[model samples]
Target: MKLLLFEDKLRENFFPLTLTRFTGDLRCGALKLRQRLEALLTDDEVSFLIDSSIEDLYSERHPDWQINLIKPGDKLFVNCLLKYSPTLFDKIQTLDHEQALVQGNALVAYRSNKDHGSFDPDSVLKQFGISTENVDDALYKHPADLVHDNGRMITYDFDNFFSDKDNSFETEPGATILNPYNVWLGEGVELKPGVVIDASDGPVIIDNDALLMHNSVVIGPAYIGKNSIIKVAAKIYENCSIGPVCKVGGELEACIIQAYTNKQHDGFLGHSYLGEWVNLGADTNNSDLKNTYKNVVMHSYNDRPPFDTNTMFMGCIIGDHTKLGINSTINTGCVVGTGSNLWGRDLISGYIPEFSWGEASLLQPYRIDAFLSTAQLVKQRRQLKLSNKERSLYTSIYHRYQENQ
Candidate 1:
């Protein structure tokens, strides 16, 4: 069977993050929503139905398969917005062939004999049926929903990544392991002394070449990615996902860091998401909870008004290639766009647009040439060069931003 993962109307709710990647690419746990779905449907052929804005970049970044392609057989179309649940298959099991499984005001999934229809997201769903009534609401509706319920999503996705018949990795001696069976290790994973992994609350999975440095504590429901280093005395609390080749230190809880990022300094990042190629300078702290204990309100470029998250805890969301100077502080629910450079003595908050050069109140639009030079230097530090394709992509996005302004 062919599996089609479709993005619905809620895509706009994911704003700046969705500007560079698809909704399914957002990291809620060890695996992306698309990866989590693929793990469950291992036997079927899978493809993503993403937005046109990211088509060029997405196709270039991932060239393995052609998306939106359907074979001449029954296909299982699934809504990528929903949380990956074991009951998903059970819910659709009762539906007959050619019948679309829907809740109230959304298209859950459907079985079609053939895949011959306009794949446009706006018009495709109408061919089936979609409405918002009072049925079992979709697990996801906005980007904030991903952050609000990420802790639970971590536990669910973790089970699929590490557990597949006696999931076992490796660990060095002299490190404390709280529930060995619940932890999964990848190849060549090294551990230093005075490192404690508490897996009682949930499972801990460390990927290949991940170094658990001296005196660090990583609680369960956490993940350490490949070639990543957890610096000395760092306290990584529960429900966090650190992607590959990252250097994380300080304190973190319920956060997600994409690949090739750096936070190797003394700081507190909680309940947030960091895009790829981010670098957090020393002592850069983000406020996750407010003093008044109210739901976090976030401002964005996707719309005119600042939106309410209705969640009590939320940190700042940093986009890719964004760098923060030493002691830079960010306010709660702030959104920083990609290619932004911030370093100033002030505590910054609010929405910082892409390619912005600033220190809080003072911000200047970063020129494309200057931004590309800095981006190339940052990539070179990791022994990688910025590709021509990436340069073109950035140029396109810059032009689009100018048009919007």
Candidate 2:
């Protein structure tokens, strides 16, 4: 059977994170949603059906993968937003042809034989005679959900993928590890002197080429991705996932940081989800809990007021290509949009629109030319070029935001 992962209409719920990529690409634990699915369904031919807006960019990044290609055979279409679980996996394995598994209003998966050009859940249901099967499996309704479930996912990924006994690397003197059996150190991992890894609570998996510098402390369940650096005296709390090529320091608690980001200064980032290419300036801190300890309310891309998250701990959700100024303070449950530059000592709060300039009180639309120029420079620093496709996408988003205003 062929496996096709598809992003549905609720993609906007993820906002700025989903602005540049697909929902399946978002990282929660050691692996991305797509990677987890691919690993579980290894026997099947896998493909994707993503939004048209990011098709070119996605194709450019992954040229080998198939997108929106439906072959004439038994096909299993799974929702990219569905959280991975043993029950979900077993149910998917038992799915019969022309069966649609759903959870409330959300589509979980569909098994079909007819090859249609459009493969959205709604389109598939409309075109074929399918029997609906309701499921209780959870779906990721917001970005904050990833943060809430990070620790559990980390433990799950570790037990399933890295439970083998392999002690290949050596740690420097003064580097200590607690619950050594629960820790997995990948190839070329460097644990400098005075580094302490405490996995008494849960497992810790440091990927290949990752460096934990002097005096750094990491508690589990946590995942430090490939080539990431934990700076000197850094304290990484449990339930944190730092993606590949990142440089992080200070204190991080229950956060999901995407690839190529930097938070390498002394700051406290808690319960936050940061997108790629983001840089948190020195002393940048966010308040996860409110003064009253009430549930945090966050702004969404949908047409509605800020809604309660039902959780007291909710930090900022920063979009890709955004940079925070030194000593910038982010308020609880703040949502900062893509391509924005925030500076000054003021408290960055509320919903910041895309490509915004200036501080929280007086945000202005960032000039497209200036944004693009800086973006090009940022990419160049990483030895990558800002291609015409990216420029065109950014420009269109800028115009769309302006037209709406």
- Top model by lDDT, which number? 2
Off by over 4 Å in 2: 126-128
lDDT of 1 by residue, 1-405 (tens): 777887776666676666677778887778777777776764767878877766766687789865656567777777777675656666654455666656655677766775565465445446644322223655576566776666676677667556753766545577898888778888888889889999999888888889999999999788898999999999999988899999999999989887899999999999888988899999999999899999999875656578788898989888788899999999988888878889988777888877788777888877889989988998999999887777886777777664465
Query: Please, what is the whole-model Cα lDDT of each candidate in the order they appear?
Result: 0.79, 0.89
lDDT score, candidate 1: 0.79
Error of 1 at 291 (Å): 1.7
- Predicted model with the maximum TM-score: 2
lDDT of 2: 0.89
Q: In model 1, where is the ten-residue run with the lowest total lDDT?
A: 128-137
Off by over 4 Å in 1: 102-106, 128-135, 164-173, 402-405
Scored against the true structure, residue 402 in model 1 reaches a CA lDDT of 42
Candidate 1 clashing pairs?
A: 105-131, 105-132
Model 2 C-alpha lDDT per residue in residues 159-266, reported as the tens digit of each score: 999977565557899999998989999989999999999999999999999999999999999999999999999999999999999999999999999899999999
